[model samples]
Target: MQCSFRQLKEKSLSTEVTQMQWNPKMDLLALANTQGEVWLHRLNWQRVWTLSPPTGTTEGQGVTGLAWRPDGQVLGVGYQNGQVVLCDVEKAEVLHTSTLSHPVSCMTWQEAEDKHRVTSAPVHVDQSSSPVSSQATPQDTAADFLPRLTPLPKGYSATDKANSEEEIVEDNKRLSSQTRLNILVVGDEAGSIYLLAYGLFSMGQLAPEEHPQAKGGRLLSVTLSSDLQCLSAVVQHQASADTSQPEHTICLTTYNTSLLATRSQELATLAMKYGQVATILGYMENTLRSMSEAWEDILLEMDNKLAKFAETIDNKDPDWQVSDEFLQLLMWGKASPELQSFLLNTLTEKGLKKLGLSIDNSYSNIEKLVLNHLQRAGQALLFHLSELKGLSLWYDKYGMLGLNTQAVQEAWSCAGSFMLKTNELLQ
Candidate 1:
């Protein structure tokens, strides 16, 4: 049977579009223009959001590629400056960012079909050909271990805290794992292809050496086969030998990616593991930053109450040595002369109590945030990345992922150390 085509609504654009892609899951369209601007529009041509180039973007570093996450919730915008920003579709909020060493030229988002493969993450450290463990594969959002991360109270965002609630981006809207295996493949001018899972995980990279012809050539496009069996790219360059006509040389190359086929299932499963870790790491970072801000606020407020005392100590010795003024008041229930002046010479008793209560409450909030949100996120990251490191044990099976065991180990240790140091600080 022959398929018939119908003409959809035709609306002309006001600018020269460099690249455009339609969201598979929605009627929205994503477009990039020569001015390095990105636009999201509905089927009726109503604009949803527009993303301008990041500040300090150098001239000529316009957008080079655009791709929508398979779920259409995020858009990966690649630039000529080797930067890729994953943005939320609803508000164009920059959810995450990554950079490559070379200029980004093309990108493709691919989703893997099940092919009767089991759906679960590879969790064990032992040698196995399959997801050999009983662990749940939301990467343990279903497992007995790795506690789930709770949203931070107040969702403290340093960048958007000053904005109104309606304008602030939601923390829950950031990138996370999908049920199916989805990979965002990016290619750059230096003949390299980056395989990223969930727009966050660095699954692997095909280096310039893999395609010598693309070393100095302009990469047109790149893609991974649906079966995960082949990697392909198109490149074009000037043919110096035929200079009279300004001849151009175009090359179409496909390399047999053995690992993609042999370990396709493992790759899909590891994606979940990496994605869970990435999401938790972002949460931990936000929690840490919020804690820092909370401490700074307390310090600033205390300065108003104790600035003179602090200055007196600074003048007495280079190293600040606290006088017995506060100690005497706390222990003897009687204030020193200076302490009395700081407490307003007699009784601003109510004001003093309120300030003390405010500080105490602030500290309690920060402590609870850390003990609840931050610690859970850090432990989850450590647990999942450790599983990733274990996959490194069978390098022959997971070698293409380029998982640096040493780096993962260091991260695992750092997460553990951070938890310990934070506990020490709290205690």
Candidate 2:
């Protein structure tokens, strides 16, 4: 059977259309222009919302790629400066944004799945929101760098999994689930592809086997198969011999969904462990800060005591100027060698007693400061030991999953040894 098409409507835009994508489940069509602007249009060609580029971006550095989340709630826009903004469509707010090292060339969002294959019915959305006319003829082949929509496999739809409102609420809370894990695949101008687990907030580059001809190129587009078993990219490069004409190449990479799932789990675990470590470190920092403040207090107290003692001596012995000089010598060690010896030779028993008491009080303050510092250090060490024990348990649990736990064991042993040394010092 032959398919027929007819013109529906048309709308004009002020800027050139750089990229666009239709929502998988709605009539909304997202469009990007050369001015780094994103516009969402309904099937009736009415504009729903417009998102401008983030502050500090140049007008020439427009959006390079765009993708819609499977739920049609978020739109991911890739810019020339390697920034990806995930915008909430309904609220017209920026939900999340990430920056990469290289300029973003293309991007695609995928729903997470297992290794088993599945199929689903094709989703048909209205084309009136499209910049091109609906009556336009279809192309035999899509542009090399442009992404195309593929129907998702069956048994993977979010609606199918959650039939009730309560179930959907529960599923929404489980953002890390395979069903909720929206993987954002980004290709850059440096010919590198990155896999970002949006739910886990972790990202890593995909390093494919080398192809000599494909060494230096700018990725034009990236698309994943319906099952997500394969990823294909279009790369454009300039040949050394032919500078005037650009060369284009297609690269196909296949991956196991199970491996990706395991990797996402590991990333989440590591992120949690690192967060725990950071909290402990922050506690230690606060303790150290407190100790510093305590030391400063001791210094201030000593200064006040010495000043009071000098004033009392001056008041009590108006005729004896030596008393004030003697106190100054003791407090600041500023007396000349001759004066020091003379004072020592002529010092009275009462004066010596007064100096001794003052020195004793200052020494007591010093001792307290030292003890406080030691106590805080010991507490920090104890907390560290407890954290190490928890890490050891984590290692034991994750070791069965083929992760390396030898480093964790080593750290645990080191903590134990340090605790013993600390105990000896305290004793």
Q: State residue 23's C-alpha deviation in candidate 1, in Å.
A: 1.7
For 76-181, candidate 1 gives per-residue lDDT tens digits of: 9999889988998877888778889988989998876555143446553344423322233323333577555655556432322433344311234353335566
Error of 2 at 384 (Å): 17
* lDDT agreement with native, every candidate: 0.72, 0.55
The global Cα lDDT (0 to 1) of model 2 is 0.55
Give the count of colliding residue pairs in each prediction: 0, 3
Q: For every candidate structure, what is the RMSD over all alpha carbons to the true structure, in angstroms? A: 5.8, 18.8
Query: What TM-score number comes out for model 2?
Result: 0.49
Off by over 4 Å in 1: 1-15, 56-61, 116-120, 124-143, 155-177, 305-340, 344-347, 399-401
In model 1, state the lDDT of residue 244: 75
**Looking at model 2, how many pairs of residues clash?**
3
